[model samples]
Target: MGELIRLEAGVEHTSWNSSRTKMAAGMSDGSVHIYEPLKGTNSDYSCSNRWKAHEVAVAKLVWAPSEYGDVIACCSKDGTMSIWEEIEDAEKRDVWQLCARFADTKAPVLDLQFANCASGLKLVAAGADAHLRVYEATDVLELKHWQLQAEFANAADVREKLERVSCTDASVCWRPATDPIQQQVFVVGFQTDSPQHSIAKVWEFGEAHQRWHLVAELSSPEHDYGRINHVSWAPNIGRPYELIAVSSSNSLSIWSMDIPSGPGQRPAVKLLGYFTDHQPGEVVQAEWDMSGMTLASAGADGVVRLWQSNLKGRWEEKSRVVGS
Candidate 1:
C-alpha cells in the first residue's frame, strides 16, 4: 500500500475544479480544505487553504466554472447550502467569504452542481424530498445575487405537487455545452423506495415557459433498476446524439439520447447497453473522461474499471485498477 497520510478531520466528500488542478475536500467535521498540486516526482499535493464551512457535516461540494473566479458551493446534511468565494487580501493572503446561503430546503441536500448557462451561471440543488431548486445569478460579476428561478420535482411520477419521500441520496449531472446556443439541460436520479421516482430523468429548461420540463427518461422494458446509485452525462463535442451513463447497485447502463433539432420537441432515449458483470457487489459511482469516450466505474469490490467502445462499437471494459 502507498503511504497513508493522516488528516485532521475525516473527509466525507471531495470535488475538483474545472481545470482539475485544484481539489476541494469536505470534511466530516464541517470544514473544507483546498489542495494544490505540487510539481515534483513525489506527486504530492499540499493543502493551500482551509476553513470552517458549516455547522454540520458537508454532503456535497462543487466548484463553479473557472470564468466565475475561485468560487465553490457546498451543501450539508442539515438541508442548507452556501456559496463561498476566495479573494486575495491586500496582505497577499487568501480569504474566503460567504457570498450567499439557501437555508429554506425542506430536506437534507444531497447534491449540488453549477452550470454555465447561456444567460448566466445557475446552481442546482437536489434534496432528499425528490425536489430540485434552481437558482440563477442575476449578474455574473456579482456572485452574491442569486434568485430562485424554478423549483420542481425531478421525476415525472413525483405527483401533483411536492411530496416528501423516503429518499436516501441523489445525483445530478449537467449536459455539456457544445454550441453557442444556450441550452440548459441536466440529468438527475434519486435513491428512494418509489421505483418510478428512483429512475434517472433528463430535464430541460424551457426558455419560453420560464420553467423546467422532462425531456427523456432512461429506462428499459426488460428490467427496472429500482434506485440509481449515480448518473454521469458525457461531454458532446459534435455528436448527433448524447451519451449518459447510469449505474445502479447491481448493473451499469449506457443510454443514447437524441439531440432535438427543433424547439419544443422532447428528446428520445434508447438503451445503448447494459452490463451485470459487476456482480457479487454494488456499483457506487460512474464518471466519464474529458473526451467523453471512456467511462470509469467504481464498485464495492474495490476496483476502478475503465470502459470504452471496441472496433464494432460495442462497449467493453478496457482496463481496471485493484486497490490494495
Candidate 2:
C-alpha cells in the first residue's frame, strides 16, 4: 500500500529530511514546497511553506542531518546551488532564509549531496562543466560559511594528462561507515558527453595532507558503461569493505571495494553482478535499504523493481511494484 498526495503538476524533485518529519518538493516553476505529515492520519499531508528558491526550475534538493537543524541544499537549472536554513526570527517564529549560494560551476549543477561524517559535514556538487566540487563547514551553526576543499574531474586521476570530457549528468554517494579511524570516501558517477570518460570514480579525502585524491576507477576502456544516471553506496554494518550500486541507461551494476590498509594503496573494486531485466526503459534512480541488503530501482517505464541477494550471495529479482 502507498499514500498519494495531490501536488502541483510540475513537481520535479522531492526529498525528506533526516528525521523523516519534513518533506520538500522542488517545482518546475522555481518554487519549493515544504510539507509536514499530519499526525494521526495515514495519508494526509499539509503544505507548511512555499518559497521561490531559484530563478529557474529546481532540479534537486537534499537535507542535512538533524544535528545541523532543518537545513536544505538545492540545485537548479540556473547554474547555481543554494543552502537554506529554517531559523527562528526575532518574533520567535520560524522562517526560511538563504544561507549561502554557490556559483562556482557557472553551469547548471546536475547533482549534489551532503555527507554527515564523523569528522564533520561535507557537501559535494557536480556540474555541467565536468568538475566535482567539495565543500566543508567549520561550524554547524554557521551554515552561511563554507570552505571549498577540493575540485577535480571524474577521471582516474585529474592531475594526470587525460582526454577532456564534459559531464551531462552526475550523482554522488558518500560511504556510510562512520568509524573515525576509517578514511572518508565518496563515489561519483559521471554521465559524460564523451564515452571515453563516462565512468564511476571513488574519491578519498586525506586527513594528513588535507586534500582529496582519486582512489579507484570502476570502469575500463573496453567496457565503459555509457552515461551513468545514479550511484548509491550501501550502508555496511558488518562487512569489512563497502558496496556500491550504479545505474546506467538500461542496466544496474553492483561492485564491492576492498579498502586497502595503508596510504598510497588503491582500493580494489570488483564487479559483483549486473542486472538488466528490471525494466524496458532507462533506469533513472536506484536506492538501497537502510540495511544495505535490498535495492530498489525506478525506471522510465513507470515501474519500481526490487532486488536482493540470496543465501549463495547471488542477486535475484525479488519483487516489482508497477506504477500507475
Candidate 3:
C-alpha cells in the first residue's frame, strides 16, 4: 500500500497519465493540479503545477491517450468543456495551455472519455441534454482543432421531448478494443426521471453507414434500475464474453454480454449478479482491475469494496476498506 497523500483544495476527480508517472486532479475550487512522484518514493508526491481551468467546479477530467502527448480534458459545472496541453514556457516552467474550448454547449457535460480508433483519436461527451456527441481531432499534432463527427440522443423515444425531463448526471465508458478490426463502441446512461433516458445503452459506430447504431440495451422486462449513476465496461482479456458493471440508486448489477461474431450482429446480455448492500444512491464508481478478474466499487459512505467470483462462479464481495 502507498502512503496517504492529501490535497488542500480537495479533489473531485483525478486521472493518471498513461505511464502512471503523473496525475491530474480537478479540485473543488475549479483548479487543475498536476502531481508527480518524488524520486525513490512510491507514495510521496509533489504538486508540479496548478492553474485555474474553469470558472466553476470541475465535474470531470480525462487524460488523452499517451500518443497524444500530455493532454487532458476537463468539464465544469458551468456547462463548458476545455482541452489542455502541458507545455514549457519561455522560462522553462511547465504550464497547461488551453487548446480547445466548448463555449456554446447546450447543456452541462456530465462525463467525457477518449478512445483511439483506426482513423484517429475520438472523444465522446455525454450531456444533460440526454445526448452523446462524438468529436475527432482534425490533426493528431494539433490539439486545438477538433471536428464534431456525430451527435445523437443517448436514449430512445425522447429525442423531441428533451425539455420535459431533467438530467442530473451521466456516466460513459468505452469498450476496450481487443482487435484492430473492432469498431468504436461505448456504453452511456443518464440520471433522469424519464425511464428511457435512465437506462444504459450500448452504441457502436457502424463503418458501412458512417453513423452510430444502438447495439444493445442493458434492460430487462422484469426490472428497471432507476437513473444509472455509473457504468463500467470491464477490460477483456481472453474471455469469450464481455463484462459490464452498471450501478443505479438501488443496486449494482454485473452483466455478461456475448461478443458478436459478425458485423451488424447484436450481442446477447445476461444479468450475472445484482448486489444492493451499499447505501442506496450513494454508490459512486465501479471499476475492474487490469486482469478483469476482480471488481472494485466505491461509495459516498467512504467504503471501498472488492468483489470476485467464487468457485461456483458466483460473484461475491471478497473484502472492503473503510476510509478514515
Ranked by TM-score, top first: 1, 3, 2
Q: Give per-residue CA lDDT, model 3, range 1-324, as digits (tens).
A: 655556666788888887888998998889999888777987788887899999888989999888888999999999999999999899998789999998666889999999988788889999888888899999988889999999988755456446465789989999987887678999998899888777889999999999998888888877758768999999899999999999888778889999999998999999888877677536778999988889998877778889998899799999999988
With candidate 1 superimposed using the best TM-score fit, by how many Å does residue 148's alpha carbon deviate from the native? 0.4
lDDT of 3 at 92: 92
Supply the global lDDT for candidate 3: 0.87
User: How much is the lDDT of residue 300 in candidate 2?
Assistant: 84
Q: Residue 142's C-alpha lDDT in candidate 3?
A: 86
lDDT of 1 by residue, 83-135 (tens): 99999989999888899988888888889899988788999988888889999
Report the error of model 1 at residue 160, Å. Answer: 6.9
Model 2 lDDT at residue 42: 48
The per-model lDDT (C-alpha) reads 0.86, 0.83, 0.87
TM-score of each: 0.94, 0.92, 0.93
Question: Pairing residues by index, what is the TM-score of model 2?
Answer: 0.92
The pairs that clash in candidate 2 are none
In the predicted model 3, the residue pairs found to clash are none
Most accurate candidate by TM-score: 1
Could you tell me which 10 consecutive residues in candidate 2 have the lowest summed lDDT? 155-164
